[model samples]
Target: MLTQDIRQSAPVTPTQAGTVATLMIEEETTISDAPLFVPEDIGAGLLLLGLLLSPKPPKER
Candidate 1:
C-alpha cells in the first residue's frame, strides 16, 4: 500500500531514522534526499554478501 502510494506519488522520498536517502537515478524522481544505490554498487554488495554467507574451510584448533 505504502509502496504503491510512493510509486504513484509525484515526488518520493525515502527516509531512515530521521535522515533521507538521496536518489541519483533521476532528476524527475524528486527523491533528492534519498540515498541512491546504483545497480553496480548493489550487485557488488550482493556478491560480497554471497561470499560471506558461503561455506568456509575448517579452522585449526
Candidate 2:
C-alpha cells in the first residue's frame, strides 16, 4: 500500500505523529529488509502497560 493510502486509513494521534510521519516517508522512499523498532510500538506498549497497571475506581455503593 502507498504511504499516502496508509496515512489516510490510519488515525494519527499527537503522540504518534512523529513516528507515523517518519514511517510514511520511509515507506515512500525505500524498500529495505532492515530490522528496526519503531517508536510507535514502544509508545503503544508503554501506554498499554500503564493502563493495565493503573488501579480501577471503587464501585458506587
Candidate 3:
C-alpha cells in the first residue's frame, strides 16, 4: 500500500529535548461584520418568551 511504503521510507522519531513548536493564528474582522444574535440576545429572548408564556393570576370579582 502507499501508506506502508511512506511509513517505511520515513520512520517516526521522538521529539528532541528543548524543541518547541509555536502555532500562531491571526483573524481579521471588520466592525460591519457582526453576529446576528449573541448570547445576551438569546438570553433576553428566552426571558421574554418565559414571561409571555407564564400563567396569569385570576382577577377579583
Candidate 4:
C-alpha cells in the first residue's frame, strides 16, 4: 500500500512541477515581447547620445 501511494504521488509532483515551469516560461516570453521596454531602451540611448554631443559651458578662469 505504501509503495502504491508513493508511486501515485510521484507522478502528481512531476506533473505539477511541469505545469509551473511552463507557466513561468510563458510569463517570461510575454514579458520579453512587451513593447514598453524597447522604447525605453531606445529613448535612453538617444538621450545619452544627445548628452554626449551637447556643447559644454565655457570654464571661467
Best by TM-score: 2
Point out the worst 10-residue segment of candidate 1 by lDDT: 17-26
Q: What is the per-residue lDDT of model 4 for residues 1-61, given as tens digits with 9 covering 90 to 100?
A: 4555443444458888999989877753334544555577589889999999999989999
Go through the candidates in order and give the C-alpha RMSD of each one to the true structure: 20.6, 23.0, 14.3, 10.7
Error of 1 at 33 (Å): 18
lDDT string, candidate 1, 11-32, tens digits: 5444542244334333464546
* lDDT (C-alpha, whole model) for all candidates: 0.64, 0.81, 0.62, 0.75
Model 4 residue 9 lDDT score: 43
Q: How accurate is candidate 4 locally (lDDT)?
A: 0.75
Question: Candidate 2 residues 1-61, lDDT tens each?
Answer: 5555443567768879988778877755567788888888689889999999999989999
Q: What TM-score do all the candidates reach, one by one?
A: 0.27, 0.32, 0.30, 0.32
Spell out the clash pairs found in candidate 1. Answer: 21-33, 21-34, 21-35, 22-33, 22-34, 22-35, 23-34
1-61 per-residue lDDT for model 3 (tens digits): 4555443455334452223221233345556865576678589889999999999988899
> Residue 15 deviation, candidate 2, in Å?
52
- How far off is model 4, as Cα RMSD? 10.7
* Residue 18 CA displacement from its true place in model 2, Å: 43
Comparison by lDDT, 3 against 4, better one:
4
TM-score for candidate 3: 0.30
Please report, as a residue range, the 10-residue window in candidate 3 with the lowest summed lDDT.
Answer: 16-25
